[model samples]
Target: MKPGTFLKSTALLDGTFFERSVIFIVEYNDKGAMGFVINNPFPRKLNELEEFKHIIPFPLYLGGPVDQEHLYFVHRRPDLIEGGTPVDAGILLGGDFKAAVKHIDEHTLTGNDIRIFIGYCGWDDGELDAEIAEGSWEVLEGGMLL
Candidate 1:
């Protein structure tokens, strides 16, 4: 629906990889909906990557079935990470990457305050509504599970 809302896969997704997945919505509007799987962690840590091999270890998650070539992130430490768009009362979507890494290196930002993803989930205009109508997902809010 809107940012800060979470979409949880229902039994309808039992036969797919999205079964039991929980997605954190970062952007949503008439254009479409976009979010990242809060669960579904990847096998490798962020530092294992070639470009960030020197940074401190951070868990990487499989956001969704969309474009996985690029990396994305969400965080809560706006005071430490600037330029991010607020998703909820305490959450934010995207911001200064260099500053984030620098803070992580400086021990100011920990994994608890951030989540990295290889890709992101997306839905075209009205596509998500169709899925919801089909009972593929259950909406959750304020950190509560459905």
Candidate 2:
């Protein structure tokens, strides 16, 4: 799969934490695949975090089960925040955090234009393909889900 793909957990993944998870694939290559769960919220507001205290409140999502301490983001406002990595049409993976915060604080960026996530899902070389072969995930285009 390439970047901008979407992975939906199948029944084969039932009884696990990833069951029913919908992931937005941000990176995929010969080496590995990386993405985040877009539907699971972490029950915390964005403004509650020290780094985002100056910005408006927004929900924080549990991107996946890996690297839980780190933060990540996706957005459709590259015009407002420069240097973002494109994920799909009108969607960006990340950009300058300070600039984004500043823009948000200035009311130039609204919550509808951004999504904050913590952690991410990943698979080693060929691992994702193996999982897909085993019916663990259903791959589709990014637009189909998000």
Candidate 3:
């Protein structure tokens, strides 16, 4: 599916890591696919972290089951953060974290301005297509979240 789209886990994924998950497609091309789960939030907020304590508090979501130690984010404020890659119309994936935090601290942004996630979901070429064909996910359009 295209970036900025969504993948809703089907019944076939019940009881698995993706069960009832709603993922936001951040990258999807011939190389592979990558995204973050937008709905399955972890029990923490960004402000709880010592490094980001001065920033706005925002719920952190479990992006996926991979690279649990890493952080990722999606936002629409490309003008505030450099190196942001466009995911879809008016939506972008990733950028300079420090700049983003600075913007937040200056009241230029807020929790509602971005969505942060931990880890991410990935698939090798053709793997995601197979899963889709197997009824593992249902592609959907971006709602307000994107």
The backbone clash count of each candidate, in order, is: 0, 0, 0
Ranking by lDDT: 1, 3, 2
**lDDT tens digits, residue span 34-114, model 1:** 989888989999889898899888788999889999888898899988899988868888899889988887788887888
| lDDT (Cα) of model 3 | 0.85
Q: How many angstroms is residue 70 displaced in model 3 relative to the true structure, after the best TM-score fit?
A: 1.1
Which parts of model 3 have CA positions greater than 4 angstroms off? none
TM-score of model number 3: 0.92
> What C-alpha lDDT, on a 0 to 100 scale, does residue 49 get in candidate 3?
81
Off by over 4 Å in 2: 141-146
Looking at model 3, residue 32 earns an lDDT score of: 91
Cα lDDT for residue 128, candidate 3: 89
Root-mean-square deviation (CA) per prediction: 2.1, 1.8, 1.5
List the pairs of residues colliding in candidate 2. none
Worst 10-residue stretch by lDDT in candidate 3? 137-146
* lDDT for each candidate structure: 0.86, 0.84, 0.85
